[model samples]
Target: MLQRGVRAMRVLRASSVGLTRPAASRSLAPNAARFSSSRSRFPAPLVASPLLQRAGLFAAAAASTSAACAFCSSSNVAMSPVAEAAVAEKAAGQQPTVVLYQYEPCPYCCKVKAVLDYLNIPYEVVEVNPLTKKETQAFTSYRKVPVCRIDDEVVVDSSAIISRLRELVVAPTTASNEDEAALAEEEQWRQWVDQKLIILTPPNIYRSVPEALQAFDYCLTEGKFTPMERRLSKYAGAVVMYLIAKRSKKKYGIEDERQSLYSALDSWVAAVGDDRAFLGGAEPNMADLSVFGVLRAMHGLDTYEDMMRETAIEPWFSRMTAKVGSSSRTASN
Candidate 1:
């Protein structure tokens, strides 16, 4: 069934790229909300899944990952037996139980979510606080958002998660899987998402004081914090991001920051070219999801709107949004 676009966006499983978040070590004030400083961000708190974890005040269904792919990092972590089993099951035509550990408004998490939802893969969510990831410490040493425990196996990094997931269900079992060149090409684009595209977001979204506050205001509500902490995290957080965004603009060599962002979008659509519905052809590939996921984090802001209006990304974006969203809604029904 075909469907029109609904609302949603993605990034960060907290990329080194997005606004610098508050220190996870900051202590809460005395006499806070019903939430003790030592309390856990439990899911019973009414989230999308039994496994969903959120840090701080409210438990959210969304999760985040670093904007960079797993390949971009050097992680010595071993694959979990549970993840291995899940992959085996998926390859064998069985559904694997996926537990996604994440926080909302994270682009990388959104990327994984989009892929999972687009593939119609069934999974549960665990929302861990971005500041303090108390919910899933037992599962991972890295302790980041968008950490997915596929059965017993734990996968970190959006690119790794997507690549690993494709190993089971996405890539064809036939000769097509043997195309190393095609796989390499796909990987190149995924890298572009992390190194190039995600870098544009921080400067664009937190470009001004007003924009910074607006972004944080929404985050504070979704964030885990006492009333006092909420105020601190809101105002102070906005100011910090506003400053950091400027530095980021300079680091990425974005002279007219907004234009740099717009140009990147244009380049992305051009890479997709005219014949394909997505970079992956008929459906979203890892590249498509990464691009969409990162941008999703800035959905309600000027950056998202300007990019949508100023670039050729809309048709493809709409196609992906409608297709994935329709499938998800249908599955829910």
Candidate 2:
């Protein structure tokens, strides 16, 4: 009975904040020209400095007249049939609704936010309580969050939500051989982020008792925990998570979790190469956004600061931060 209780505690700690940092303006160097990939249907943003580039991309995206703040519905651009239908519906006054069910700390939820911000999609956020999880009770099929409702259709899982959102905005188009290869590469790395990178997060976040406590403290500060729950989670939760993180290291055969994270990021940098400002050449693709979102969850923690200091990922990360900075379209409930 004791063993079962301990296991449940570990699981609960594994599942579960927000850190508010003031935004800043930033710049980026030039990148390679656009490739002819067909997988992801992202807007073709301008390739230039931060302000000028984003300005150009926003121009391309065109401002929407709809009350919904439809950022991507440009009349000049040819969208996929599905996207066109959504636009047409919006025109008919049936504005599309997007709602995200998530908790702030989850990397998976962050991934969805990154995609939405980059795509300039307006969405509402419903922050689910980590303890009761009563908010997500309606989603009995799959309770774990990052569940999203696009209009009337509910999509579960981060990757699936991203894919569905892509279908709603951009239409498929032909790409050159080189572009196809690049898109394929983007898809490959996006999968890597989920498979290889995400698993390393908890181990580093809870590598030691202090780190674990720090993580919980940040969570409690940003979360909606009651006073009693806060005390229990801040103290007891930290110790449990610390032990679970150690066991996680053994399970994954990771001798040094930080080193593994650094090496993995190094591999990503190499794949990105120095010529391109992003994996998607001039603009960020799905893979770039995925990595940024996952890593962003570690903000305000030691592991994140160490990563910025120790790795070459900072430049690219900074550029992405500038590009995908907070979206005005987002509202939190």
The CA lDDT of each predicted structure is 0.55, 0.61
- Model 1 C-alpha lDDT per residue in residues 1-333, reported as the tens digit of each score: 001000011112222233332111111121111110110111111122223342321112112222221101212233444545455556654455667766555667777777666666666665554434556667554534566666556666555576555645534433354345555666788768777887777788788988877776654565444666556545644554465566557756788878888888888889889998877666665667768777876778877888888878889888878755532211110
Error of 1 at 252 (Å): 2.2
Model 2: number of backbone collisions: 3
Q: Which candidate is the best by lDDT?
A: 2
* CA deviation > 4 Å runs, candidate 1: 1-82, 138-141, 176-184, 223-233, 326-333
The C-alpha TM-scores of every prediction are: 0.68, 0.71
Candidate 2 ranges beyond 4 A from true positions = 1-95, 139-141, 223-225, 229-240
Residue pairs clashing, model 2? 17-105, 36-175, 36-179
